[model samples]
Target chain A: MSQHPDSPARSNSGSHCGRVWVIAMHAFTQLVRMKVFYFLAVFAVIAIGSNFFDLPQHTGPEVSGIAVLSSIKSWSLGTMTLFSVVLGIVATALLLPKDVEDRTLYTILAKPVPRVDYLAGKLLGVLLLVFVSLALMDVLMSAVLQIRSSMILNQQMDFAQGRGWSAAEIASLRGDILSQGANASLQGAVFAVFLRASIMASLALLISTFSSSTLFTSIISFLIYFIGHFQADARAIFLESGAAGTGPVTRAISLVVSLVLPDFQLFNVIDAVIEGQAMPLLILAKLTAIGLFYAVFYVIASWFIFAEKEF
Target chain B: MLLAGAVRLPLEASLTGELRAAGLLPAPLAIGTRDHIGQTSSAVALGGLRTLVATFLNLRAYTFFTECRWDDVAGTFDTIVELAPHTIYYWETGAWHQAFNASSYYLNDSNLPSLRRDAAWRASVLNGRAFLERGIRNNPGDPKLNAYLGFLLTDHYKSRAFRDADATFLAASEAYRIAADGRDALPFLRRFQLYALARVPSREAEALALARELYQNRANHTVTMQCVYFSLESHANRSLIDPGSFAVSVFGSAQQAYATLTHYWLRGSEHLPVHGVASALRVLEAQLGIPADKSVFLQHPAQDAEDE
Candidate 1:
């Protein structure tokens, strides 16, 4: 049932890409079932209202397109990312344990599907679902903004040209632009959100494969998320207790931790992205590549540990 | 889809491999301040992207803004404009930050060689030009942005023979026209009329007209309040009669904020006037600690009240 570790290519003739597609579709379907997507759309609407409320409106609050876009990006994208992580983790946790309890894993392993193919499929499913949901929500926000923005431009032109326009008319136009801009911000592929969700889902799957009981997997996965951020702090302690003997001891402890847990903090890019600086492609790629590498390593490690257990 | 390319992560194992190859640090005390950059990094292994790279990017933007590197701040401003084409204040704030704060820094980085002072001044002038350009692009409707842009363009045209003074001044006039012609601008336009009268005396009719509008429009109410408040606060201030107006003006919402705090103060006070006096003095002193000039407003009244 097990493929050799040394070989990169699996002997199974089933296409890895096809299997991944299947997994992604399945994950997307699962996401819809989670009801979190609805939660996100509602939350985004709330964020839009909040942005509207913050406007320095007198006759009415005026907003430019830019303001509307940014508001949507921060409020909607931030909310969506949180939803994705929770959805991904819950989906992975629920699916993994259920498969084991039903002895479904044994039935699947008996087939030609490689362990790598299985792991990749599950993650791909969740990601594709996230993409679809983001696209739909982004479209709705943009359409509303376009109509509102057009009204603003017309009113501003009237005022500027000496064709008398009321202060209310000018303000309403401004408000439209701002509302639209806040909405427009949601159009960017929210890197911080997607990366975070992917890492969390992958980590959850690893926990599921290791723990025999469902309760243990839930507890352990949650702890790993919180503790993973502390990897940098752990290294500080390793250095502080004398770099020779106690240092080596501390270093060993940290290394063991790295080996055992995924570094969740690597996916944190929310603050910089929100401020509107373009993150370099290479830097983002470097982080994602690192994540893919960890995902592969962990899933395979889980497979090895799990294959030995007689379900 | 292309942005997904940014999703790549550097394998931590590469760093791990480097640490294992070189061996350990020699000195024990050296570990306190620093150590082998690679080895200690793994031992206290933070996610490299999360810690080091993100820090560099965030710090770089902050330092440019704080250190008054107008060019760098302008570059960042432009990037932010692109990144958030929808946010109105993002562009306006960026322009203001560059012109007022960041550009001020280029006029001052001590590291510039004495020979580069001429070059630095030229750079500072260039920084102002770039900042105004951003304002023009993002905040075209803003009178302030147009005024700054026109002033900058005119200065460059005259000083360096940049050949754009007419266009720049035209733009400035347009901004002033917007500010002066509008209903909101009426009060401000009156101030200019008054100032012109004080300077040349030929604009007396215009000044009188503006002063009449100030009375009729009642838009000058806030200004009157400010003048009256200062007079009274300064008159009442002393060792026994301190004024809180200066402190409240700093928050700009001092009346409302002090009112809320006074609710708590009222519960415990014996001499209501003394409490008011002490509270006012304490707030004034606290505010004066930083904005020393605000305390200067009290100078005339303090002296006159003492004589009285």
Candidate 2:
């Protein structure tokens, strides 16, 4: 097979990083051309529309705009989660089969490219797509939230001034509104969304390595995604079940299930952020470590299986 | 995969516990909540769209609110809070629906017998209080929820729903105290706490100290706060100060003291303590040469007269 002039495999200074970048960018362009970014438009609408959910509040002026702020974060982050996960799984599940069907995998393997680099590149591509999409969504969410929160603060200040609210009261109200606005915690939540999607993408890559078809990979990935949310609960039952008189058989099964499934519940700190809780950097760092751990393990596992497979 | 899972399982478990302790992760969904949210919502909620499901249910609860389906409103909010227990909006809205909207609905429904209507109204108020108390439990030290509980306890009409006045005022004071302790709590919350505490006869000494502390800040010298402070002070030092002289010193003049004390005295439905108010009003009135028939004491308390 003839190598393209721009191919990393043909470069004079051949490096794994260069080859992975080339393949990852190729995958990104391929997926982008599939018009996956179009979902960002839908996300824009959802984020902007969430602002209008300013339901007639029953509380005093102190909490006037809070529900709307929560609404915006909930709708925005929720849409990001859904879109990123779907894009991560579907885009990844499609990549391997599409490459095979196009005979591109054969051509790539025919080159000096390592299979692990190729797998890493492809997973990185899906992750890049998910990260970019979430970043864009986060920007839109932050913009809408900032503007709405400012408007709310102005209205609340006017009301407070009219009612002769003290300086401390006014400051307190402003602090409350701003806490729910565009803040570092909200950014951390968007990053958490990206991390969760990255895990899904890499996991889907692993599933697709041995999966018979795209449909099989997608279905299995989704099932595992849902079941992964419950893995922590199963683990808990196993850990604490000794005194609860759970039979040995039950404990053993729970242990096996817990040991085999990814614990997706660890990423659910996003919910608390939506409720205006602060996300400590330490926690986000821990979550990042977990995400990297999962992705790296799944990708290596995929390579182990793919390394021996006959294409 | 097993080895990887085994290695990460402890880390994951520890992280899970930490996240939960930090209020970053909610408790696992209860089985009944799963049934309540139904198949699709439960699936969505479990799929990491818990807050999204909660937002949708909030809309649904609004519909139930419009149709006067109080039970449906309550049930839907039950599921909403279960999904997003950390969101104070859902908790406050749920409590409002029960205490204010549902109670008022039953209050004015003339078709039912008065006894049944009264029972339903009182039950709705109690349910609202229970819901707010549950919210406080879930979000301990949350200023908004605590303030809300305090407001519900001190509401003119709703306070009647509580069977024990002293315990009700004590609880309200405690709630306001917690609320005032919050970092962003309004300064008024502290004064409100003092107001609630002063109404609790057993807590008058503590309330007096708080009132003095609050009064040192002139911003807290609202008419209600001043009146509450004066009454609490008199209760704390009943034998130490002359009612008329102390009243004048607090209010700056006998006429001003009489005017402030009269207003406070007439708001009997608020359940505020009177202490030296009536005696001070009498001395002020006598000194001002007010006629017997025109005396403030002869005028019935406004809310008491309305009740009669």
Candidate 3:
């Protein structure tokens, strides 16, 4: 895919895309060598272990025997969410300090690479790692869910048959069981997890740009993460000012918190999906838009801060 | 950073509004629940593992179940369902643990006084019903919740849990009717409707109509359905139809009719009406080989067992 020798891509690597891609690949390789993908093994164990939760079986025909399928998706996706967010935050937080510690920051700055390219490239690399980890975990989850769903489907069909259910009833049972299985909605949910992690990664990048140390960045980023879940509530309080008899200082504080923190709760459609609710593509699109907005704004802010740094 | 926040705040607000309107996001976790979950759990749950936290709570509830801590079981499930209100399994399991397991434990508890045991048993059943009703409200279109409600209302073995038998059956019939709505409803739900409605004295006409409609389907020809159909038909308009013809039509032969009617007659716990069963059984048994010693009247002892 390399350009011809005379082309711009081959000349001095001055093209921003070329430089950024190089850095991103370098950073991706750097993170990958850290053995971060080992978490997928743990994820597989969780996915498989969740399948064994059908204890004290429900004793009626009203519900199918496939509650375990839902349990599998819930546990797997939950693990995926935890793993992805941690990876996104820690990896992004580690990048800048580790680069500086290795003196690669100096060498890279000694080149023609812009600081923005370096930061953006590092963020992209973390994103790529997160995306790849989530994709692997999603594949494992979908596979387990698909297999378990088929087994549950068979069990339900047999149970329905023994109960002499009609074709319509059997079809309904099949649909219910399949809804809890791996489907497009589940894929959309996994993507929502990824989107949440992506936003966290970028936010960590922004924090790391001004942060004194990796530990500080990670801690502050995590604090923001937990607080971000309440950002909407703060926004609501600010929006409905004086309804609760609060004063102006409280309102100002809430407004600042709401305006600053990314609302992490919006990505919680994953919970609904785990509950077997259908996720409309339009809703996923809206969530994607929100994610992109946060990610882009954070990266640009990081660029603005890093652009003038004496390092 | 503040400039970026200023530029994107409205956009974030607008998208958040849209997402909330679309029901793609849940409301913020309440402060009380945050306190209940504590700092570590609050952090993990807010970190996008809310359902995982709910799952752990479910396991904890199960442990409470093993230890026979009924209140703790109930409390953990309350937390679990709050974390995952859309999950039917949590609701169903919670209700089952309360209504069946915990209630049964109370019923047989030798340590408790009789009155206290009875009160605890009743409370457990009621709590389970309330939980299921809450589950149904959260998941309005779920046939499983409706069907489960119907089962609980009309359960023969647990009839003591309900206050008014007639009203309970009527409510059960309604529950089944809702469960049977749409093309995908299980055929048994409609049959269950007929069964429950047939037991309601004031709803005999409506029950007979449903019974007739469901009788047209071959899959609804279970013994209970046939018994309900015969009883409802007799209760609705006994003067219009001959008992023997109806019995033969339903059970295929005189002997089979007698035997099936005898079984239905003896199931005292089921609360089935014997409006036409006895007279029809008499005529059929007289024609069949039932001797004087083994007459249909001899089955009164078993029928009386249902009253006890």
* TM-scores for every predicted model: 0.44, 0.95, 0.91
Which candidate leads in DockQ? 2
Candidates ranked, most accurate by DockQ first: 2, 3, 1
Candidate 1 per-residue lDDT, tens place, A1-311, comes to: 23432344544454466666665676567557766577666756765564454332112122223443444445545556556666667767777666666676677667666666666677677667655655565565455445545655665555544655445545544553454443322333355456666777777777777666767766776667657756434544543446445656667786556555555544444433443433455555655666666667666666676666665
Deviation in angstroms for A10 in model 2? Answer: 9.5
State the local distance difference test value for candidate 1: 0.48
**Candidate 2's residue-wise lDDT over B1-308, tens digit each?**
88988898899889999988989999999999999988998888988989989988988888888899999999999999999999988898999999999999999999999999999999999999999999999999998899999999999888879999899989999999999998867788888898888888688778888888888987777889888887777776777868889888888888888888888888988988787777677788788888988887677532322121
Off by over 4 Å in 1: A1-16, A23-69, A101-103, A110-112, A140-189, A213-215, A230-266, B1-308
lDDT for B113 (candidate 1): 68
> Model 3 chain B — which ten-residue stretch has the worst lDDT?
B299-308
Quality of candidate 2's docking, in CAPRI categories? medium
After the best TM-score superposition of candidate 2, give how far the Cα of residue A86 lies from its true spot, in angstroms: 0.4
State the displacement of the C-alpha of residue A92, model 2, in Å, after optimal TM-score superposition: 0.6
User: What's model 1's lDDT at A4?
Assistant: 39
TM-score-sorted candidate list, best first: 2, 3, 1
Mark the 10 consecutive residues where model 2 chain B has the least summed lDDT: B299-308
* Better by lDDT, candidate 3 or 1: 3
For candidate 3, lDDT tens digit of each residue in B220-267? 788888888887777666778678778998899887888888888888
- Tens-digit lDDT string for candidate 1 (B172-212): 43554444554333334333323222222233344344445
